[model samples]
Target: MSRQTFLEPFNAKAMSYAEVARTFVPSTKFTQLAGAWNSVLVGPRGGGKTTLFKMLSVEGQEAWTGAAAEPYKQTVAYTGVYVPSDIAWGTMLESLIEAGQDETVGILFSEAAFVTHVLLSVAIGIDRHVALNPVLRLEPGAETATDEPTQADLERVIATIARLWKVQPVSLSPASLVDALRERLLNIKRDTRLRAKLKLTDTPTQEYLGIDMLESASQALQAFDAAYRRPHHRWCLLLDEFEVAPMHLQKTVLAAMRASGAQKLLLKVALAPCGPDLLYDQQGSAPPSQNNDVQQVQLWYADKTEAIEFCQQVFLSRSSIYPALAGKMPSEVFGTSAYAVVDDSEDAAQIDLFTLTGRNKKQVTEQFQALAEKDPTFQEFLRRKQIDVSRELGMQPSDRHGNTLRKIAPLVAFRNAYKGKSVGKKRGVKPFNTAYSGWESIAAISEGNPRWLIGLITRIMSNNDQVQFPVPTPQQTAGVQWNCQRYAEMLQSVANEQFGSIKTSTPIYDVLSKIGDYFHNRLVTATFVEDPPMSFVVDERVSDDVEHALRIAVNHGAIVCYQIAADVGGFPTLRGLRFRLTYLLAPVFKLPMRKSKSVSLSTILEAKPETPTSQDDPTANPAGQLIQGDLWAN
Candidate 1:
């Protein structure tokens, strides 16, 4: 069958579960955001933040728990309102600016408009919850109860407004105050049209409007719930893209939500990992991360075990959706001879010879025949080498008979030809090679991101899916190279987008290029040393540009920067970062699949001034003692 027949039904490239809701496979990220808990969810763009938010919805959760539409098994009535931060913030800014006020007054007015919108959402949430209770709807006093409850709600909202601004003479008319508040907010927005635009700048000012929105939302939620009398009298308010709101808004909303003491109202917000820091209160003094106020969960894989199983489930989930993939292993559908090792399978041996030595089977066979014609002993060894006993484990001919080169023809040829510079145990250097391959390699290339892993597979499956559209044969080295390069570039594009907004000296493209170039030059001789490290240690002394670049790289997932204690020049006991390109990009650079030793900045280069330098200035030897490898200097 065509690969499309088996794979197309399972494509999850959108990385969303809006349509294929049934095919939504749950991960640890799902479990963390699934219930009534409030969180500052920190992860990359496609790290399933939006997906988790969707999965927390009544229908989305039911699809997971195998029940009727319910957000969770808890008694709370749930309402998931997806508020996209950038869009909402932009719209509010536009409306507020249209009416022309001072930039300061305009910003405060915009914030007020936004907070009002959020609180109204809470009222609407309870309204939706209340709509479900027929007994409460039909109650004799239910219609009459709305006026008193709404008036009380108006008093609290008005009080919050009164506290914020001293100017107020017009009657609020509590009977239709929500409508009045909406109109009042609209009027402020309309007033902005008479003025010029405004921009938020970094200047120390205390004109910040901090009347708590979450507390106001909570108050409304409680009042509406009581007035309508919901079955469980509980509600979950999901605030998505909460981090994009002003830092003050984020802090005040979360702080007030925690302080609201409204058990019936549950607030869950989705936030990016790197942003105007949300962990601290607005004053930056108290941290609400004390478990009582706000909880945190990062969406990332802790280890290969977690990454492998999660990716496997994702693959299986996609496959299960297709009728053609019902009983077949992913290898059968995806062309992964996962059980095939380059040194074990005959086909794999040929493929690996081409990959390792840049030789085709025909050239290897012709060379073998030419060698046999010249030497009888070599020919006899070749016969014995061809006798497969137990694949790679089986011994080849003894070294006595002119070193009968068999099994890996390419390896034997390399050893026989370059006898003096052989990369073997004889030179005290472990083999300069990596044995990792197949499905596990694919998993590692994902770098623990489910969206990336699924994307990699879906892209490969779509190979020739656009042109002739044929089922690709099992993993070929050249094919793997092409696919991995494409995937890495895809990741680079994502990194570009993530770091695009940073108006700073650290351009992401330059950062990635610098890191890639540094390691490419450094790792060439790493195999000659004993247990060489693959990672690079960048010191703070190199340049501020480098430090900022590294930070941006780590945040955007371009490279994994790990902090370590090391002797950094004069600061012998200083702590700094050690970095390696995420393993996903390993194939792109042809680096060892296994993690490597850390290369320190002290060796690579010292900061040489613009003036001429002496022989001791390290500029004379940029490679340093470790990289100078005189023994490998052919």
Candidate 2:
């Protein structure tokens, strides 16, 4: 498969089965799974339950192509079953019986069922071959082949199996016929001709018992039943993706398999996150009866350390299900690296990107220094750009921006003037802000959701050197203006996607637009001010809505949120937060706004009384005013 498609199954990363089992710290649930019994994997999206399920149900399936086969291969001796919801119940049952006809082919049952005294376990759809089907295959006029299997083909196979194992072909009574058929089917051994045709493996762990080709359907079931009950050998059954199966069928199948006291038959089931809930929901409020007895296994996320280790392992182990980029750097460019540096100072002289090196340092120090040293003109230019945007956006002397900046001047001063450098200097490193500083913007935009932060960083890095604007030969004013406009449009689009639609009813659009305008203005203003406003707050009345929207935007990775103390009643209340408007809206849809802060009645009603006048009089008879007389009042 091509590299892009190769990693599709493993795209879930830490949430996948192998990673979760390996990296998740051991818990009671993990220990329970280690013991025998059925299991229900549970977790929210991205929690890694599915990954764990795959690890247990399909051994060696995820191994790298052409790798050495597993030692002590856990050949599936029983029938393991996977019941996809899309497949009809009858179709699923049929496939299991047909596949199980090969006495030597260990049947993995996707669902459960019972026979008289003999519990015939079946693993419904355990096809290692199907799982390994190539994702891409050739087609005429196709640029590349795709490997998606046809569901219709699978259903046919299932139907074939059901017909073969069916008993009393002409009868309407299913229970007795099914019972008789189950006995014959379980005892039957593989047909020699069928075994030879498939080039069946001869390993003791993998027996390929052939099925009778010439025998009619009824005759075959009868022969299989007689042979299956001999008890010389055991039949194993595996159930997979149980959550997707019909609840009634699942309960019936599981109940039957458990009832059969046969020693040789073993049952294994694969469950999804909601497996338990689905099962209980199907059963209703009544407590499970004495007849119901099945063990359960639960899968969940590994501990933080385990999760980190799993992530590292996923990056390191290139030959497993998800191979890494050969010779690529193991450490993430945007991860919390020791190379970053932070400083709190107003002196521009203190910042230098090139000479700085230390663990857990902020990038601001080195970035501010580098910009101030190598391209001081560019640094000054950005500051002026920010100031201009702020003024143009109407964030003026008494606006929210002005108020927030006045309160957090010290922090802005520190951020603006500070200089620091990364540790463990390496050659060919990009400038600090350009390289690692965007993560701060990402974090600022995403608020703290690692997923959103990663996505934003990934997008930014992907397009970092795309030459988005025209290069200036003479640096004319028109060219600069044109480039700036293009840049602004791009920034606006990103902001709109990330935070604009968070609330349709509120003024989020106005807020974000103002913020973006303020950001552009600050870049320009920072050049001249002792410390320009790097952050601002919305009106306190809308703080909750703003905060909630900001959080959603951040989680989806639209922007970063930081707590800032403002002068509330003169005690430096920490009531405000700040973000980069552009990053918050970078990943969602973009709709243009006709205007920000449209004029309305509320704006015009300055100092108006809460209640309206009771009545209106044209005159009180004093000039044009009507006078109230004592007689008229009586």
Candidate 3:
């Protein structure tokens, strides 16, 4: 298969149910989501939300085979019904609801239609489960039966559900039952539009709209369980890409899920990190509070330790498919990073002292002496920390606790060592001021995003006909930069589409451009300031336009948001938010792929915007050389 196939793995929605399950590598969040409770899975676009949801669905579970899936299969406590949505469907529904002659009538019709849609999914999920009965059984304590549903039993169950839902099926089988619900939903949509066109305020729904969908769906599930001889089974409604649904419909679903006491019902919803503000009621009732009502599961990993582990797990699981990659670990292909030594599947490698300091003890001492002479800050830092680079670099430390070498040595060394080094005059000959190599660096750039991690590795493999183990550092840097540049350009394109035409001094692109330059300046300044500011705290006094643009930047993954402070209850509040450029764009700005000191968003915005510096400007930066057109156009 083509290497391009590996890139497609990042898109879970595009894959078949079997492929999704087969390729999925279970993460820590899986345990949290597998519980028989309600949850809202929030993450960036390419994070593993859809993949997890799909794996929980009946089809994915059934298609799943082999030892890797055994533990997860055993965790199945409820039958999952996956309800997928898109922008087109959501916009259409929103328009239909808005066109209603009467607000109340429109809401009722939309609510009923939503319920019918869920029911159709539920029936199909149960039908698939029934087909596997008698032959395939789930882990112990699941709602599996020794015998499959007989024709009479199936007919009776279908009749019970149809009666409960106030619908009629032309035939009695489960497939027909699913068709019946589908038709009812379609009819409701049609009647709603017709009512709007005719300016009729009377209720448009032909069937009863007063029934509680949550309770009614629960009742239908029970009927199936009873007929199949698997009583008291629970069902989870898996709503994927939920942010696409109209605001009113989203609230309706949330309200229903919160209000209903249906013991058999569970809920799992997935949406973007900046999805529409969830409100159970426009009036006074409390919104669904995390921990109190639903578990808020975030798919992205910000912590470096956890991020690398997850990246390695995904690499191992997916790489096995290719014969050439069999039994190989990430370190073998990507090699060790210069910034930090990350634990790999193969035995951990020792950090190379020569890379950070010099070729020998005498050279290392002279390098540090030269840096301390030019930079007083480095002199003070060395004295304050009692760091003896000569001894530390040339020999083992007497006390490991006092040795900051493990952490600060590489960063400090790179800052001073690469000072004043010009970008090589020849294209592709002179190297970057800093290296973005090693598995650790790759993980940092991937930003705990599985799709990104996969894409970076795939691009590297594709660039080489047969990649050698422990691929060259320059090759890794090339792959990393190639992906980073593409991402930067993609973000710029999205910015143009979102805020380009808006008459503003700081379009989203400008904000990004300004911030990128500010960070780049910190990295290449004449003075060495260890732990330069990379993160930013948004000030409340910013203009509405600027604030909106920043929010868009976050939603598009141009920047990442961190909750620095929280309420007394430890929940995230608006005041607690912090923002930083995604590390995936680190190479573009020639900044370190690490989070450090934070400055205020207002600070960067308030600074007089200079033309982007030579090293950082996409117009001139080697990283941005591939970019065409005026990316920084006013």
TM-score of each: 0.63, 0.33, 0.82
- RMSD of every prediction: 11.0, 22.3, 8.3
lDDT of 1 by residue, 54-157 (tens): 56654344445455323333533465654434444445554544544345555665676566566545434333433343222234444544433344444455
lDDT (C-alpha, whole model) for all candidates: 0.47, 0.31, 0.65
Error of 3 at 561 (Å): 3.2
Order of all candidates by TM-score, from best down to worst?
Answer: 3, 1, 2
Between 1 and 3, whose lDDT is larger? 3
Worst 10 residues of 3 by lDDT: 625-634
Instruction: Write the residue-wise lDDT of candidate 3 on 68-108 in tens digits.
Output: 88888888888889888644435334556566555556566
Candidate 2 — what's its lDDT? 0.31
Task: Name the top TM-score candidate.
Answer: 3
Give per-residue CA lDDT, model 2, range 183-205, as digits (tens). Answer: 44443322322333454445423
Off by over 4 Å in 2: 1-35, 44-79, 87-302, 319-329, 332-634
Residue ranges of candidate 1 with Cα displaced over 4 Å: 1-20, 62-80, 87-103, 130-193, 197-211, 228-232, 257-262, 277-281, 290-292, 331-437, 464-502, 536-538, 561-579, 600-634
Name the candidate that leads on lDDT.
3
RMSD score of candidate 2 (Å): 22.3
| Model 1 lDDT on a 0 to 1 scale | 0.47
Among all windows of 10 consecutive residues in model 1, the one with the lowest summed lDDT is 565-574
